[model samples]
Target chain A: MEAALTAGIGTPLSRSAADALNSVDLTALTPGTPAFVGAVERVLTSFFTTRREIVDPLGPVFVDAAEALAQFVVRGGKRTRPGFAWTGWLGAGGDPAGPDAAAVLTACSALELVQACALVHDDIIDSSRTRRGFPTVHIDFEDRHRAAHWPGDGAAYGSAVAILIGDLALAWADDLVHEAGLDPAALARFAPVWARMRTEVLGGQLLDINGEAGGDESVEAALRINRYKTAAYTIERPLHLGAALAGADDDLVAALRVYGTDVGIAFQLRDDLLGVFGDPAVTGKPSGDDLREGKRTVLIAEGLRRADPESAALIRTGLGTDLSDADVDRLRTVLKDLGAVDDVEGRIRDLTHSGLNAIAVSTTTGPAKKLLYDMALAATRRTA
Target chain B: MEAALTAGIGTPLSRSAADALNSVDLTALTPGTPAFVGAVERVLTSFFTTRREIVDPLGPVFVDAAEALAQFVVRGGKRTRPGFAWTGWLGAGGDPAGPDAAAVLTACSALELVQACALVHDDIIDSSRTRRGFPTVHIDFEDRHRAAHWPGDGAAYGSAVAILIGDLALAWADDLVHEAGLDPAALARFAPVWARMRTEVLGGQLLDINGEAGGDESVEAALRINRYKTAAYTIERPLHLGAALAGADDDLVAALRVYGTDVGIAFQLRDDLLGVFGDPAVTGKPSGDDLREGKRTVLIAEGLRRADPESAALIRTGLGTDLSDADVDRLRTVLKDLGAVDDVEGRIRDLTHSGLNAIAVSTTTGPAKKLLYDMALAATRRTA
Candidate 1:
């Protein structure tokens, strides 16, 4: 009924349904959209608090892990996965004031745990020393080992602790959903999507690792990894899960899929671009960190494809190797002059527009569409 | 009704319940009991088969991980965790012929995955070269890297893959329970126990790792780690989960907990004994591997506590270092002279008796109680 009135095609909506639409800013994106994402930080704190209470009695060292996991999660993240999920829920005609809202929030917040696991383990795999401008999980543990003068190789001990902590976060993520008080039917609907999300993200990550290690430079492989590694978890599954929670039908779900896929890919594209070009002060990471870590992103594939022979050789030499600031600047100039950055910018614009149009055709309220518009912009045009 | 007849102090069981009791051989333990364990092999196979089907299309390299996980799970394990879970369900009045029986099996079978996660990551953390007389997961991956000449430190590469594989196995174990088709009410009862089990096991594993790294050899700490690390996960939680699935009331659950904790700790004590005294051909792992690994078992704690000063110095020297055959023999003599070996064996017998007595007094039927008795014996007296 709300959709009918909003589309200007049928009888007026009931007062409650119309009130739901009127309760928030519909004409423009409310700045409070990020509030939902921020709310997850508190949920993480509570989760760890309760977990510490339970496991500390088992052992004080367990308490240490609880603290580490909580610190890692609450320390930083845009909570973008949960944000996408919230947007998807709103877009699927679910009212934020509805009975299942808190359950939805709890379920969505579990994404942070999944992301924590990925980042913690990813840092170890990459041998990355820093994340969010701080020592990554393994490195943090390593530093603790060094500080205490612990036995065994400090690096290996740190990695072991990080591995166990990552494992705990993943397990707790599963528990978060189950303990969220979703009815059996909702849980049944949620399980397969959640399971698939986990498998695909892991698969995508493995693909990324293998591509870099195996030196596979194919654009197709890079794009595939992009789709699964970031897109699937960041946007696709979150949308699917939210829409499913809102009891979305086939057409609405299908529409959200198209929107989420394009937008998510664009989001990752912007991240890749930022990795090379953004200032350290702005991005909280050293510029050209990707060049050093050798992320096999679509942008890199494009640069390799379009660069002149000399530039191509330089790109190859600099990829996955230590890069001085001067080397980063040289690669930046190549990316710009060879038209890779321009090409990627154009692709991002196209993907974001395609995603926005998909949202437009869906039967969600106008306000939901407007919020999604802002999300797509926030994801794609942040640096620009 | 079956419980009444089993204790021989009340009315006889109904024909079907009595028939259920008579269906399996209970006297002297049927050899077909291992068949229950062998069933977990198929579950792991099917788990990988379906997991591969879902992930392989997204990335073929994921198939490699699935293969590795399946190999690790199937290659070797006593399947003892699942066995204990099955026994718990049986002893809690859950009929094997009932509708929920298959679901119980599926849920219990998931324990194999948890154990797989532990073993895989434990091998990496311990830097163990072999498990079950075969290369461990990290070692196997390292060998693959060396064979392929992959572009990274083979050790780091191996650890990375093993970590990811272990993470996947942990996630899938959660999925196994969620997808097991337990009704909502059943899930509510089961979730807390499952969650606690995962947390405690990880906690226990962390504590174990920390103790070795910190080199604190206190007997109390060793026993605490033994309880949380192996006893709680291997015996207590499995029984608790099984009993909860059968809708066992608090009293019965408490009874099972007592029985499981005793039996489980005894199980680990026997393992420690076997690690030092058993033949490599029987245990599959090298004899005295724990001493080399600096495991800090209760027996070691006792030896360290009770050995004469010169013997203690010799024992400390032999701990956590490469041991020649003569060194191993000397450490063995220290353990024997200090009465640690005899003390541990005596504790195993007493704990096993306590566990068997707890099971005997429970309201489970005659055949179930008989099976429990044999299980305690098999777990504690399995040298042959």
Candidate 2:
């Protein structure tokens, strides 16, 4: 069934290579490890194929939309959530070759679907035009509407269709988890984790939007948003879910959560830094995109608090404005001079250290411990 | 837990009277029977209370949002989906006093949450201001944003928040089903039904928007959209889901689906008529709102097809445009004169007849058959 569903989707990348990594050496399970990433990609391909079949009778237009969603899922960013989940499962003494391994992989791959829903909806909410060097779903739809000379407001049509598409992605995410063939016992344990992760992420989004609308720029507010919005779903819950799936004890689960929270915050802090300073070529967005959007990140909050009065005024005025290259450079210099850049880097180091240390002291399997440590460094120190 | 959750939420209507409905006699199980409606209400209340606690720590604003959501779920239009599901269960010989009754109630009540998600998102997509005599979620949020003197565009914030709220409701709907404690075998049977209903409704919505944007006017297009958009989720799938939960055989499930489809379509036909000619005070909108919005419903499609050239030209010109009250009256006259109203009424009668006939022949429980017959009538013939 899996093979049939994935037929004509390009061949799975290096399954043999991935399978080879499973032989004798379990320590090679770091984040974005190709072995697990390949397995996840195959699971996603099969899932989308099933979805495409479900929507086929709706008509060519709907079929096209489903295909677009499928393509969007199959292509793009590092599968960080799944990678962490793999490590967590391994850390909990779950054997990759065990009978439950397939079910575990299927279950964890669901995080990617959730991520797809988030990015698709978030793009619509933020009115982002591009992502990963391609037009965002709404923008793509808007372009289609205009090119076809369709009646009505193109932008409204775009947003409306994108809303449905995002909704479809979300519904499909739940479906994938339910259909993953997890045993009833495992499913029962994983249910609340799934539920809480969903609510937490959405609640975090609500808080972030509310803060933006209310002009809330407190460092505390920013940190709180980061913990829920990016941290919990992205790392903490995925790890916890993996551990629970393996029937790991509470001690290990709690320790993993501690590690997850620290690492997740560090991940978001890295994101904040990248949002302002990363090259457009690497980030697929203009430099200082967050600043241009007046996003209230922890880095920005700290800069506001620490800068001199004159520099603070400059930072405030430059935010949410259309800045030239030179102007962005000027703002960058000010932030660096204010020591905000160094402060954030220092925080990331401290958080990563604490997170790794937690894992170090835990009863995590030796192989997964090394992988988790490697994942921490990669997550915080990546260029994009 | 249920009582505590429902405390301070106002008393459920006539629980004892409803309980009496289960005494030896079963024919009292008609759609919207107070007994089942009250139970569904209690389930929803408890579900929302749990959600409120989950979001409480987020702050008072979020708490208010959750409260508003809970209130909206409790106070609204007839609980039609739950009513149908209950009838389906009864028809399949489900025992109202059985151990599974509460679980079934909890499971079926999820339809209400799905409906909540649909209405909230639809209001945003259509930019509707009110529903069922109350301000729509987006409009309510927009008002709050304005009153609070928030910095961003109030409309954008309203739509964004509504999107997240809809997402939450959708997620909670799934959680309710998972938490309902349905046996694994029952869950397995019900999973596909639940999954399909979600896809069909969202797919229907995509079709509706596509029709509007692409100027699709064929009666075929109109009927197809109506079937998937309103009929499937609203009636057919709810019955199928309930029957599945009750472990009904496929033959009975098939019979129920046929009845559901016919009744569901008839229900939408009535709705289309109401859209054009219902009393504004009763429908909670100005007269001819659908005509003004130029919704491409079956009634409108038939009108365009059957009218004389002059009347056709008139409809083409008037639809989707701002018009005076006098102009609306003129359009109403043209539609009536074109026999469009009679055409739709004829369709409703025929559909409702076939729907009731399906139940008449089925091996459905005597009481449930009677109830189903009554529900078919109420669904097709009601004004609001």
Best candidate according to TM-score: 2
Q: Model 1 chain B, poorest ten-residue lDDT window?
A: B9-18
Candidate 2 lDDT over residue span A1-384, tens digit each:
113222312211112212222333333434575765766787888777666545765677788788888888889767988877877888999887677776777788888888888888889888889888899998999999999998779999989888888888888888888877789888878877788788888888888888888846778888878888988878888888888888887778777887888889999999999999999999777888888888888999999999889999999889889988898899889989889999999989998988888789899999889888888888899898
Chain A TM-score across all models, in listed order = 0.87, 0.88
Docking class of 2: acceptable
In model 2, which runs have C-alpha deviations exceeding 4 angstroms?
A1-31, A279-285, B1-31, B279-285
DockQ of prediction 1: 0.28
User: Residue A294 in candidate 2 has what lDDT?
Assistant: 82
Cα error, candidate 1, residue B264 (Å): 0.8
- Clash pairs, model 2 backbone: none
Residue A115 of model 1 has an lDDT of: 90
Question: Which stretches of model 1 miss by more than 4 angstroms?
Answer: A1-34, A307-309, B1-34
lDDT of 1 by residue, B246-312 (tens): 8886666766777777888898999888888888998777788778766689999998899788988
lDDT tens digits, residue span B1-384, model 2: 113222312211112212222332233334576765766777787777666545765666667677767777788767889888878888898897677766776788889989998999999899989887789988898899999987769999888888888888888898888877688888877887788789889988988998889747888788878888998889988888888888887667777888888889999999999999999888777899898898899988899999889989999899999988999999999989888899999999998887788778887889889888888887888877
